[model samples]
Target: MKRISVLAAMACLAACDKSGFNYDNIIDDGGSLQYSLLDSLQVQMRTVQLDSIRTSGTGTGLVGSYADPLFGKFTSSSSFRLGLPSETDPGLKAIYDSVELVLQPDGHYYGDTLPLQRFQVYQLSRPLVLPKDYDAFYSHQQFPVNDQPLADVTQRIRPTSGNKVHLRMNQQFGLELFEKIRSKSDDIKNEEYWRDYFKGLTIRGVDNSAAFRLLMNDTAVVMRIHYHIVKETVEEKTIDFHMNLSELQFNSYSYDRSGTPIAGLTPGADGIMGETTGNRTFIQPLTGAVTRIDFPSIAALKELGRYGRIMQAELVIKPDNGTIKNYPVPPRLTLTLADKKNVVTQGDTISNAAGVQYGNLVTDKLYPENNQYSWDLTEYCRAMMAADEYNYRGLLLAAPFSEFHTQLNRLVVGDGGSKQYRAQLKIYYLLYE
Candidate 1:
C-alpha cells in the first residue's frame, strides 16, 4: 500500500505538470487521490418561449414600443381602473376648468428616448376583470378600448429627471367627468357606479417609440379634474381621481418577430437550437423568453474513475459582442431547473451552500472579451450525477421574477461552439484509486 501511494502521488504530479493543468490540493485517507480538470463537456443551448408570465400588481406599468434588429419589435401598454375622489362633491357652483392625466416615471426605460415619443390614452370598453379561474392578469391579457383616443400627446420623455408628464385630455371627456362630480351624480358617488361608467383607461405608445416604466404607487398616477367656484374671488380646486384598485393594474406586452431569427419560435414548444441560429441563444424576460442549457454528455464524467467527486464546477456565460451596445442586458440572472417539456420545476432554483445564486456578473466595456457572468455549479453537478435516471432535465437561465414580469431587460449569449464568445463549463474532479 505504501509503495502504491508513492507511485500514485508521482503520477498525479506528472499530470499536473502538463501545460494546461494546475496543481490543486489532494486528499489522502488510505486511498490514492488525484485532481483532474475537464472543460470539454458538451453544452447544448436553445431559446425557450414561456407560455405566459403574470404582469398584474407588479407595482410598475410599462408603455411604449421599440424595434430591434435581433429581437424584433416589442410594444407595451398599461391599463388600470380609476376611482372617484374621497370628496365626491366638487360643489354645485364649481365650474369645470380642465383635466389632465399625470404619469410619473420610475427611472426605468429601454431603447432610445432622445427623440419625441407619442402616447395615446383610450378608455376601455369594459372594466378590467380577472376570470374566476385566474388569480392575476398576464402580459398577454388585453382589453378592448374605444375607437377614438381620449388623450394623445407627443413629447420627449426624461426618465431620470424626476419629472411628471401631464397629458391634457379631450375637452368633452373632461367636461362630462367634471359635470358629474359637481352634481354629485350616482356615477361619481360610489366605486361600482364609477367603474361602470368609466371602465378604465389604457395608455399606449405609437409605433417606433421607446419603452418606459411608470410608477403605479398610490400618488404616482392620477387624473386631476381642475375646477373653481365663483365665490370669494374664484377659489380654485382640483379633484384627483387615483387608481382605484392598484392590484388590478397590469401591463400588456406584445412582440413581432416576423423578420428576426426567432420568427418561427413557438411558445411552449421544443425551442430553437443555438446552432441553428448562428450558435446563439436569447433571453428577453418581457416576452417570456429564456435560455435553456443542457448537458447531454455529463454522464461521461463518471467513466473517468470508479470512485470520484466533483470538487468544483463553474459555468461562464458570455454575451455576443456588440449585442449590448444600445440594448442593455439584465442586471442579474437566475438559473432554474426545468424538464424536457420546458416546464420549470417549482422551488428548484440552482444555488450553492450559501443561498440562491445570482450569476456574479463582470462587465468589460473597453475589453469586451472579458465580459461574462459566472456561477458556481458544484452542488448542482453532484445532484445531477446522483439522480436515479437521466431525467432529461436542463437549466433555464432567466432574470429574477421581480424584474422578469415588469422590465424589458434582455440578453443574447453564445453557445459553447461559438467562434468569438462561447458559454463554458469547467469541472474539477477528485478521483480515488
Candidate 2:
C-alpha cells in the first residue's frame, strides 16, 4: 500500500509545470547579495607627457655607454680633481721612471665585448672649483683640455671581469712633474697651489664602439709616479696622487634620441597624451626621459554616493612589446607624486618590505602574456578623499639611480584606449548603505 501511494505522489509532482520547481520563487533575504546594492565604480585613464629629470653628481661607482638602434647613442665620462698626497716632497735626486693611471673595474657594462674602444685621459685647463657648496655638474659642461693626452689606449676591454686597467703615461710629462715636486715649488705646496698647476683629470670614452665602467673611489683609482732615489744604494720610491673625496666627482652623460618614437615628442616638458604621442610613451635613465601621468576623473569617485571605505586602489600599466627587441629590459621604474609646479615631490611611500610599494615599479618580474605592473595607490586615494592639501599633482615614472648614468634599459607603455592593453585603474571598496 505504501509503495503504491509513493508512486502516485511522484507522478503528481512530475506532472506539474517547470515553474512549480523554480528557485526564484523563494523569498530572498538580501544581506548576502548586498554587493549588488552599492553604487557602480568608475575608472579613468589620462594621457601623460615626458619630463626631463635633473642629472647631476650621482655617487654610484658606474660609468659606461651603449648604442641603441631605436634611441641612438649614449656616452658616460668621469671628471674629478686629483691632488698631491702631502705638502712635503722627497729629496730631488730620484730619477723618474714613469707615471701611470690605474683604474679598477666595478663589474658592470651593457654591451657586447667584441668591439674595441679608446679610453683617453685628458688634463683639464681650469681648476674644478665649484662656485657654491652644493653646485651640480652636468654632462654638457664645456671644460677645455690639453691638446695632448696623458694616457690613451685603443683595445678591447672587459672591465667587469675583475681586472684592473693600467695606462702608461708619457715619461717626459712624468719627469716634468717630478722636477716640480723635487724643487718644492709653490705649485706643489698646498691644495690650492696644486690645483692651479693641475686643474683636474677626466677619464673619457672616445670610441663609439664600446663603453666601460670603473670604480673611482680614492682607493681603487690612483695616479702613481715610479721613481728611484740614488745614494750609496738604489732605493726605489714612488709618489702617489689620489682623488679627493671632499671634491665633486660625477659621470657626465649624453644621449642622441634622434630617429626613435621619442624623437617625435618634446622633452623637459609635460607629458603628451598617448593618443597625441602615437598611443605610446618612453622612459630611459640614459636620457633622463621621465613619463608623467594624471587621472583627472579620480576625484569623482566620492560623488558616486556614500561608501563604507575603500579596501584598495591600484594603477595598472601595460608594457608595449614593439620596443622590446634588441634591448635589455629596464631594471626598475619609480613612480612619484609631482607638485603643483610639476616637480617631483617627496611623498612616495617606497619601502623595501613590500616589492610593490606606493610608487615603485616591479623590476624582477615581467608577465609575457599580460606584460603589466600594478601599483598600490590606497594611501594616495585616501588622501584625495580626505580633501587634504596635497603635493600630488600627478604621477611621474623613471628609473632610480639615474642621475649620472645612461641605463640602456628603456620602457615604453600603452596609453588608455578602447584596446585591452590600455592603462587603467582598479579600485575595490565596501558599502554600508
Weakest 10 consecutive residues of candidate 1 by summed lDDT: 1-10
| Predicted candidate 1 versus true structure: per-residue lDDT over 254-361, tens digit per residue | 999988888988887589999999999999977978899988777655433334456788999998876888877666888877777888774332664323468856
For candidate 1, the TM-score is 0.89
- Indicate the TM-score of model 2: 0.77
TM-score per model over all chains: 0.89, 0.77
Q: Which pairs clash in the backbone of model 2?
A: 48-271, 49-271, 49-272, 50-271
Q: How far is candidate 2 from the true structure (C-alpha RMSD, Å)?
A: 10.9
Instruction: Encode model 2's per-residue lDDT on 59-153: one tens digit a residue.
Output: 43334566776566777777787768763476756687889888887755666667877778888887776546546665555467899998787
